[model samples]
Target: MDPPSSSSSERWLWWMDDEKKHSIADTIDIEKSEDGEKIDARKERIRDCMTVLGGFLSIMATGGAINSVGLLQTHWENNQLREYSPQTVGWIAGTNIFLSLFVPVLAGPVFDRYGHIWILAVGSGLFVVGLFIISFFDNHSAAPVTLGMMISSWGVLCGTGYGLIQTAVPGVICRRFDRRRGLANGFSSLGNSVGGVLWPMLLRVALERLGWSWSMRAIDGLALVMLAIGNGLMWGSGVPAVGIAARPEPESSDNEKNKEEQEEEGREPSLTWGQCIRDGARCFRKGDFVWMTASLAIFQFVVMGVAGTLPSWGQQQGFEDASLFFYVVAVVNAGAAAGRVVVGSISDSLGRFNSVIIVQTMVVIVGFGIWHNVGTNERLLYVFAALWGFSNGAILGLWSPLVGECVHTPAPDHIHAIIESLRLLTELVCGVSRLCDVENFGRYLSAASSVVSIAGLLCVPSSAQILGTLGPDIHVIFFGTLLILSLMFMVMARVTFTGYSFKIWRVV
Candidate 1:
């Protein structure tokens, strides 16, 4: 009745149980027992929902646009940029992809020191403004889109905007939700898939009737609306309305507990930039964290190849119509949307690392078995797109939750001391349970993104060369092989974290 005052494990179980006991009668009983506590809990739940909504809308604008790059590439090559080679055009997309990921290195630390509101506002402005500027440079205009124009607007401005939004959205989620983090992230990530499907369809229709100039503007208008609503909801939502109690590490000493309480009471000093950098650096030292980053980086390379080139490969196989490529992109994103929700839900019970290992196997299978063999058959290509999208979506959606787990995991060497430090850090930064150090999460996320951005920068351009010099068949083989290697790293990460003991299968 009075919010569980028992041990941390029992408190955690109580929260889970309370979630299940959802009924009007139960609500009435809770309110009757403690009006103030019940009201606070209700407010917290509402804020959590708002945070998820904000994340979904924000991701739809940013990540969803990124997902639609393949469609944009097809448009550019066919119409305005037909004179250039695929490899050359790829540099534009590569630049966008690179900035979208790489700018997070700066955004993450800035987010920790500042907050999310201004970051979201600035990012949304840049992204929308870039889109508007690009519309004027469309083939319909006097000054058609040039390499410099494309790179400057989409690559530099929009990409930097995306990086900032992406960093802030997840940081807020990590602070608010703990046990249900995977599910929350999954729901938020679903926005990208939805955006992927919607953007292509809208662009296809607009391109047919309105032409390229208005099509870009139309989507930019929609993006502006979505981003505005997202920013409004996300502002001032980082700190949880109710304190989520976390079980202290069993090894924590009384002094450590005292320090944690003091930090929770807002006595902790403002973290210096050096301290922020040092904390993020510590993540690299953990075997599991390092292995996990490598796994994600390699798999990201695979994803970039598939997302950027699959439609082009279809065009090469005699399906030249842009309309059909639109359908292909849509189907893949539809499958991805389903996968994010389904996989995120299951990861809570099955374990984050285990869920990735399972899904990534399918990624490998689809890459080698399905995509490699599909040549001229339109139906087979569609099938491959769907399967690839679904499996790949699951793997991509798990990265945030996996990173959260790694940050929370006790360091391999220090054990007790690191646990205490992390606990203190969590309370000091987020005023929530032992999920992750919210202030430092951006940097860890940035570290992972650093590797991913490199993959993004190279995968499309390099794959285009492979497509030209060799063939789509050889490109598939290369992509599939990378997936296999990444899968191995995933297993290594799991083992390194849980160890070789019987506790290997423990819900990690």
Candidate 2:
């Protein structure tokens, strides 16, 4: 013990000498220090911020486009790729989801240990390469041979660069917010709806103005711009050494005033994998998963189905883009982007679970009937777009937070992964359903919309359509019914939470 003390003293004495010398090699803040604390200067790389923001935007793009190709599935079947089946074309979009979700498990850890600059860089490269691949591959060979649905579009090139952004986004958000986590989350998620609205219009324009090859090339170019911006922004946001934060960085601080307040936030030290698993298991055993997963699953069903059908819905409603299929998708996405924030804020105040019920019910009642039926009128379609944008937007924000309610595990990773996988499938199904209905010329949609509205009312936690008839004046009535039902369920949940935080059903 005496000998060890002598050695420890020598190490401290050496550190003190280094500090006195102001040696750059030994100095923590020799380059630039955040909040005036000693820090490894290299930790504050500008590219890291851009990587974080880009990561968020990347996922937003994936979510928007995941089910989007279905909007084109019918078009593909009828026109340039008439020989292709709907399911085959649908697979391209499906593949996007599959790779986007399942393949990126390691990304979070990678970003945590290393920084997101290279990840985002690779993402940018993939986006460009994927787009270019689709362009040349779609054009070069003849219909059956070059156009073989199995070979080209679905080929490995498609999902590669297309979704690198998604893999990066959440990790960035996680790093940025710990206290007002929900607020940061709300804004970050908005990117999806924004991308949803904007991309469709972009695609619509290129489809008509540029035709197939150049149109896709144009999109690739646009993606390049987005990527460049992400790179620039992320690069500007400096990276800090892991586990070294007494105060926020001035350049890229979370912008919080009270250090104590920041400490109180959700960004607390995350539990170890073993500990997380233990908590997650207990929560699942309690049955929180059923409610949370059901809610998210159903929410996706409505949103994805709508996304898939939006362009065709517009087409059936007699608002065909003619040459701007992608453009129309952009319009729908734009509305969604605008309205989703509305949904998020409102849901936060009204109750996350309740707000979803209210929003989806309205979509079903008015959207399918008044909007879908009247969407045939140009002015009416404008109204419909506004209505759809507002409601669907709410769903994105409301669902994820509820996962804690559903999955009580110490670690949410398992639940999040399973939900992501299941939700992807449901979205695919919803997309396919919407496309099939759209091809049937909008009649089927009108009927389904009414039924789905009622479905939202009954589902409170998931997707279960109780009504058989496509009821009349349903929108106005459902508005009342939705309010009543939402309040009722909130009361029920509140009572349960108050009683025991629903711990009884916590495990399953």
Best TM-score among the predictions, by candidate number: 1
Candidate 1, which segments miss by more than 4 Å at Cα? 1-48, 140-145, 174-183, 236-262, 266-275, 408-443, 500-508
Q: What does candidate 2's lDDT look like per residue over 1-508, in tens digits?
A: 2222333224444445544534543354433445344344344433443444554565554455553554554455456565654334444444444444333433443454455667667866765676676666444236666455433443344454444565455545556556655655556666776666666666665676777778777877776777677666655554443422323333434545444454564233333546533432333222223233334434444454444334543444355556544544565667676666676656555655556556666766655466536634665656666676666665555545444332222332233465556544754664311112112211222222222333322221121111112222342243335434443443343323322233332321
Number of backbone collisions per candidate? 0, 57
Query: lDDT for every model?
Result: 0.77, 0.48
Judged by whole-model lDDT over C-alpha atoms, candidate 1 comes out at: 0.77
Q: What would the TM-scores of all predictions be?
A: 0.77, 0.60
Which ranges of candidate 2 are over 4 A from the true structure? Answer: 1-71, 104-106, 109-115, 139-164, 177-185, 240-284, 313-328, 405-508
Best by lDDT: 1
lDDT of 2 at 40: 41
Q: Tell me the tens digit of each residue's lDDT in model 1 across 1-508.
A: 5547444334434545555534533555566669888888998889889989999999998777788888887777777777778888788788888888788777765665566777788889999988988887666233235767887898888998998898778777877799998668768878889988988888789889998888889889989999988988887475633222222323456878867875776434345668856766666756677889999999888787677887787777677565887888889899888787788778989999989998998888888888888877789988988888898788887887788777674433333665557545644674423224554555577678777889889988887878877877788898888999999999888866653222556676
